[model samples]
Target: MSDEEKTPEAPLAAEAKTDQVPSSPDSPVIASATTESERESLPDLPATESFSGSEPESEEADGAAILDETMSVRRLPRGLIAQILAPEDETPVWIDPKRLGRQSRRDFLLFGAATAVSAAGVWWLLPDGTKQQWLSPAAASRIDSIEARFGVTGQRRERFLGRVLTFDDDVAEALYSRNRRVRAYRPSDVTPLRNNYNGRTPTGGYLVSWKLTLSGLATGKETTLTAGDLSRFPVRDQVTRLCCVEGWSAVAFWSGIRFAELLRAYPPAPAARWAAIESAVNLDGAGQPDPYYVSIDLDTALHPQTLLATKQDNRPLSLAHGAPLRLVVPMKLGLKNIKAVTSIRYTADEPPDYWNERGYSKYDGL
Candidate 1:
């Protein structure tokens, strides 16, 4: 029984092996079963003609035409587009990334430079910032301490400033500075004192009896001149500015006689180096000869611009303006132009003046 079953199975296996045998190369089955490598080695099939019957113009032209027709443009997506559309009011039309980088860098540099310059300017203009250049904080503190301890008498500060002013004045005088002209204005431009006035009104009722005394002339004699006597001299007018140490200033038309004319009439002695003029009014109630006199250098007294004013703005002098007479010297500060004239004396020595003792500069030029 085992031999018969085995014989049947062997025959069936033999038939299966025969049926699996390869077909001939000439058969359709063998051609259909060809591998991709074998098919690739064979010649390619002819392409179908695109145009009906026309031949191409040239091989180069046909190749170019083919490339042109087949070329595909790859465009960026809508979301990837750069600056294009914009509102009309917008300043920048388009912002190029590369250009913006360069401009922003330049603008940053300019802004930084401007900020630095502004900071330096502010530092230079402020007193606290510039104080180091004038004096150290420690030195200034020491000066303040000395003033406080000395009870505000200004002795130390006055001495210090006096030395400073001496040096300053010496330099200024030696430099041959040109005299600054006072501004001129029409007589109508006289700004009335309205409300602002300086110093006190004249007391002792001397405005009525005030007379100008001229002494120590070339003749070594004394001469007293009244308002009528001064008016007899040649009358002149000058428009000059009166600048006060307190920082108020005004321009006025002053009608008067030039001191040069007066000096010519009553010449000064050759030995005289100074001219002292006294006022009839007392500034200090104590009457310590206070502001009673002001002395000018001989050169200043002889300056062409100096005046012995009898009138102001073409009108007779008012009581508040030293009624009878006032010395109007334009080249000097208003303080030096003694108001209420009582006496004029020439001396070889520097005459004592009211403010000079008060620690003010004698050469108070404009």
Candidate 2:
């Protein structure tokens, strides 16, 4: 296939524990955290760096007294709470007191009130003397007042808040190596999901007739390709894990042309900073108005491990696994590894993806 042959490559929560039992007589009970900006400013320690979790000799004597005073919880330094809650390996080297914002009495009171309200709701929902009502009238009334004040319906608020919350250390680590390979797996290790297909499944005959389309390249050119044309490029096979948001993962040997190679073969316009991948399946029947698609930054689209995957485990891709051609982006979450890809478009604007539109982050890396 040539530039003249237009083909679409179908492509592409945490809880706070307030256990304050001191470990040792000399150990401080409260440890603080730096602000997000301050943390950002510090250089990341080498993986070999280690801290014994011991205070400096100069501060050791005073640390215990400070610990006793802050152990009350009410007077606990806000930054200290975060350090106390974090696992030892993930904890910061040192907490900067200056980063702890001064919360006024009113702010403290409001937090206390919110905690009380939450406790009340939990208490009301528990069975008491066989009166297992889901919620007590008083609790429900208070909740309703809060909801009304926020002008948010219960379902909408829950879904929105759910997506916005995170406490996973792995997630934080993933950001640093968003474009680097993180895990590997053997062919047998690849998970075969019972219902991996996210949306519409392509027809059994689709692959035979499928054409890959490329448009909006830096060369001000367009191209269409057949499966054979893709094979003509250098092929790479990588053992990379696919981490899904649903909490399952599999390592599979994905074989295909590096996406970088594809881009080099069909350069996009210099102004293009984003690439959109569209699939053949359209479960919603929304048609052109709402075709299922996902977009990624050009840097990601060109990651060496990113592939126009055509095979899995040295065999042709199964239909359920985005047969024919699917995207393989090791650094990104599963949603961006679009299946049964049909077209690729380059643009200056960041194109939206199916999940991103709903609530997921645009950079669903790692």
Candidate 3:
């Protein structure tokens, strides 16, 4: 204990000479010689030291004060650190990269606000107007209520109810179909009159009368026709042929009354059988209603010359020919003759005739 105090203090003589050295079985001995100078300046130290034990510097300062009291205490368990930072029933949990970039910018602003509300609801439901086929304000309010109740003006002639009708060439191809400029009034130019007569014939005294009326008769009932019911209905002269399925032909002189005497003064109901009629002018503007509408069969509305005219040749009937009332059926064709008779439906089916629903040929009678 005297040769320099038994040769010790060189850092306690290198910590008691590495605590009496004896570490080998493939070495890993660090018991602190200042942790072997921090494991030899950390060149990843390890070439051998096999640890055993000894005061190894108070067991390396009580194992570095129990690893600094287990790294300052509070180890895990707040539900295991919220289940190891949350997901592990076999891995997924990543998200929080700032909530996945705020949920992909709130799903790209809700897919650009649902594609701008589906392109503004398809430009507010389309359809505007310019006439490629326009007319739906209830078919332009039924052609402005039949040209404000049957337009009338002036023009004079005088013939009323003469008879003997017949026009041919398939009634001039159903009233001018392939439109060869209205096939020039075929059926040999014209000459077929008398149908239903309600007369007053005195030629030059200018009194050609012949009236018959029935405003709107779709069963909603409303009927009127006087002048003593058109002279108590008898003068029905016969000579028919106004055959005009557009092809055109006009003998002219259809008198009045007889739509089987105004459908027997408003009868229709033995399950009727169809007889649409209705006209006033729009013919094809797509806005429907005009000297157009044709559907028949109630055996041609009780046929005995099916009329409702109001005079044609001697006078009275004028608004371009279908005055006040017009519908003469001498076996049809001439679009079932409807012209300003407002309404008259008695259907047990088969109605929709305007040019047979536009494609033509619905018997269109002879």
Candidate 4:
């Protein structure tokens, strides 16, 4: 049969009515058409595109119009919007190697400079010479006043240079009556003469002989001590311990005239600040004046305990110890109390002390 003849004819009125009406209770119902305004108010259905190669031009135009409308509705470009919403990628900033190294070097240099300045300041503040602290200002001034009124300046340089002014021990023995006394020995009947003759001056009254020349005193001429002058000064006795810097100690009974009394006999200049004591022995053996000199302030010189001892242990001093006149400073160490004193000088400046020159403490006092 032909294709046109095989096609079914249109249904009769009854068959069409039956098809339009619901055949069963589970059948879906179809909406009836309304007015044009009502149809316009209904929600628009989504447009569809055909996948067939021969698409209608109107359909393509409609699709392009929709895409343009959607693009216009966006507030920003798609790429910009995506970037704003995307997670951030972070990178670390690196420090310059050169800059770090420079900072380190600067810190090191600053530290070193500070240390050097501190060291220099300490060195500058240290004391230069051996002037004792107690003899510094007020004490020295008092001594100067006494020296200026009564003390005479002597030849101090020769004493440091080791010039020995010798005297006979027999004279010292005759002066000290105890030297002639004999001690009885229980083992033998022989009585031995109490002679301690080591050239050390025993503790007793003895005259200290030294050439004193004062430029400002007595018309600037040399003044000599007369025998009568020795007789005028009264003698006193004292017992003191002599402590040497070398760690030796000895107790000796010293007999001498007070240094203050002797100073009153001859006066020094008013400008005198320190009293220098010089020993006859050049302890350093440098042919220079005895290096064993001590510079005392005026107050220490005038102290009641200061003496020019001529005897020791109730006998005339031996030569090995300081004979004749030796300085006895009770408050000071034995080294400061110079032995064999040959001269005394009063000066404004501090004099060189013996042990201080040998790296010992200058303030060697009790």
Worst 10 residues of 3 by lDDT: 155-164
lDDT of 2 at 169: 26
- Over 4 Å off in model 3, which ranges? 1-261, 278-292, 295-315, 323-337, 340-346, 355-366
TM-score of each predicted structure versus truth = 0.54, 0.57, 0.22, 0.41
What would the per-residue lDDT of candidate 1 be over residues 65-150, giving only the tens digit for each residue?
23233122222223322212322222223345655565457558979999976754443333442445567877655644554564
For candidate 2, the per-residue lDDT at 278 reads 93
Provide the global lDDT of candidate 4 against the true structure.
0.50
The model with the greatest TM-score is 2
Residue-level lDDT of model 4, residues 1-366, one tens digit each, is 654455443222223233333322211221232232222211211112111213443344323433332111112224556746755433232445655465457557878998976754443333322122645656545544444354321223223222221133223323433123212122233222232222333333333444322232323344655434554788877766656656666556678887778767766567766777776543333334433578766556676677777777657766556665677876566677766675677777777886667555554554
Best by lDDT: 2
lDDT of 2 by residue, 93-153 (tens): 4434443333234347778999987865554443332222555766656765675565644
Question: Number of backbone collisions per candidate, in order?
Answer: 0, 20, 30, 27
**TM-score ranking of the models:** 2, 1, 4, 3
**Candidate 1 Cα errors over 4 Å, as ranges:** 1-157, 172-181, 194-199, 283-291
